[model samples]
Target: MTDSPLHVTVKLNAKLQPEHRHELFEDPLDALLESAELGQLTGGGTALTDEGEVDYGDIEIALTDPASLPGVIELLEQLGAPKGSLIQRAGEPDQPFGVTEGLALYLNGTDLPDEVYEQCDSNYVFEQIVERIEGVGEICSWWQGPTETALYLYGVSFETLRERIADLVATYPLCQGARVVKIA
Candidate 1:
């Protein structure tokens, strides 16, 4: 049997353009600062201080299994920004998988259109999962395939991941079916 991987969630606060708020992106500590600067100049938001930096607010990032980091980064780049970036704050763990306190599950599926896939980012999926699990304490885990295929999700025992998968499969008209798989 494989052992569960250790995971750590990081939080970052940044300054961004309020106007371009919808187009913001998520990044690590260093990237967040750079993105915030660029976002402020492009989005037209004012820097809270005279340092020419816009306050993009805070974001909480959950790193599940750590092995998924590369995939997560790809997802973020595709999506405009990180998930739950609009509401998350520092010093928060985004609740727990169950107990109605944190993000529930991670989602994976296929059959996504080129345009849709291009528009999607890790942050987008991450935020979607967070929204679904909010107050319910679950995580939604699923994946989108390139063609007509089943959405398979594994390693999601948290309520947040579970609910997220359920919601995405239900809400997204593109998906046909969703299923859960055991983590190897």
Candidate 2:
């Protein structure tokens, strides 16, 4: 059986102002699912349903190729215009550990072989992991900020991440000023 493309659902906080609320969808069907799923995930509305509760509160995107994830994430950031906080993860819910800030990249350690530190792309790494472990192996998610937006990705590759970062830097001048945190 063919596997389903990874599904990402982005939920915007209810407190955001109307002006900041905007919607961007790569596919119409995925957009519809995102709206429905986000509403369900966040619950109805705190006030009333008819009040037009935060129109841009949710977003969804489907990804098949892991290499395409970083680019997809860059697009989401551009469309949503994030203000704060970006996080990424690798693998499924119970077993996920690679996380990155600023760029919204994550890697799955469990999926990798003991010595496979570098790979062509995050997606390739995931694929390799899957081959060894019998699971799909690539998963990632991102959040724009408090009331900004959130996104999810699956089957992503490191080469994709590098390309995406380059694209982001070119497209968003602000990315040039981004700082990476290092631990000793």
Candidate 3:
């Protein structure tokens, strides 16, 4: 496995928005590979659900390391994959973490103005989350939809991440009824 070119599909957390997921995971993933000398990130074309039918979040890196698999999983736990997360492209390994096994906080975007607001301001939901989750977690991805903004966080312990952001979820106007779902 070490000598041969192997396919590693590191299935991500399920709660993250399935669109453009590469942006959420690519930086850390590339750094890990480069620092560890694992392999290069050969870009993949547009991803699809069924034979290029839909817009799929696609990111590609190369490797086939049986020995390093456990270590890989450990490092990637920040992305919410505490268990084994990779699958062989050639189907060697049978199971991979589900695309749905992840966590996210959905904050209402209704009243939030487009203007920039202070960190703690209810209008600036992203900054508020970033400030509170200093070490607990990092927002990996976010989706600003018609109704709400889904903030996908990256962290080791789900409990800690929740604790760090609990106050905002409870008291803040925009986050008053925020939903934090941990699918893992």
Candidate 4:
């Protein structure tokens, strides 16, 4: 991995405006900064447009290492951001890193209105498999739909991630009726 800075473009959740970022993105952004090493949120923090709509959703951050891109995306997802974001060398769009390297699994089982909230602890289930994920993977960095808060994951390989999380998905009460679909 190069020590040269790279730009990571994060897609924010348009459902929320800049005013809500303090509670939604600030904490995680702060945590991410600890690892990303002083990257700033530029271009995406502007106020809402005159129509009261989100004018922009992508925030570009400078990273000290290209390898930390995935970690950055993972942290953003944990805070409920939209997915499908990308990273590239500071000035080279054609040279974006890992565009094809992203693989994901959506745990559409947790936080279901039908499931008991206490039992649907998405983070709890993650705790059970964090150690088992020997392969590269993470919760959604690029996801679809707004029907519900999607509990998705991104990984280097879908089969590996599915295998790693299968046990938890099969046995967890929260995972009942949950479909683990592979994201394109």
Residues 16-111, model 2: lDDT tens digits: 333233322234334543554421112211221344322224434454544554554554454432333122333534211222221222233244
Q: State the RMSD for candidate 2.
A: 18.2
Error of 3 at 11 (Å): 2.1
Residue 111, model 1, lDDT: 49
Local distance difference test values of all predictions, in order: 0.36, 0.33, 0.58, 0.53
Ranking by lDDT: 3, 4, 1, 2
TM-score of candidate 3 relative to the true fold = 0.61
Deviation in angstroms for 178 in model 4? 1.5
Write candidate 4's Cα lDDT for 145-170 as tens digits: 34323344545565777788888778
Give stretches of model 1 more than 4 Å off.
1-111, 136-165, 173-179, 182-184
lDDT of 4: 0.53
The sequence of per-residue lDDT tens digits that candidate 3 reaches over residues 24-137 is 456677788788887656764443334222222434667656566566555555544523344445647555543223357877556555442234454366788789877656
Clashing pairs in 3: 14-99, 14-100, 14-101, 14-102
Number of colliding residue pairs in each model: 56, 11, 4, 9
Rank the models by TM-score, top first: 3, 4, 2, 1
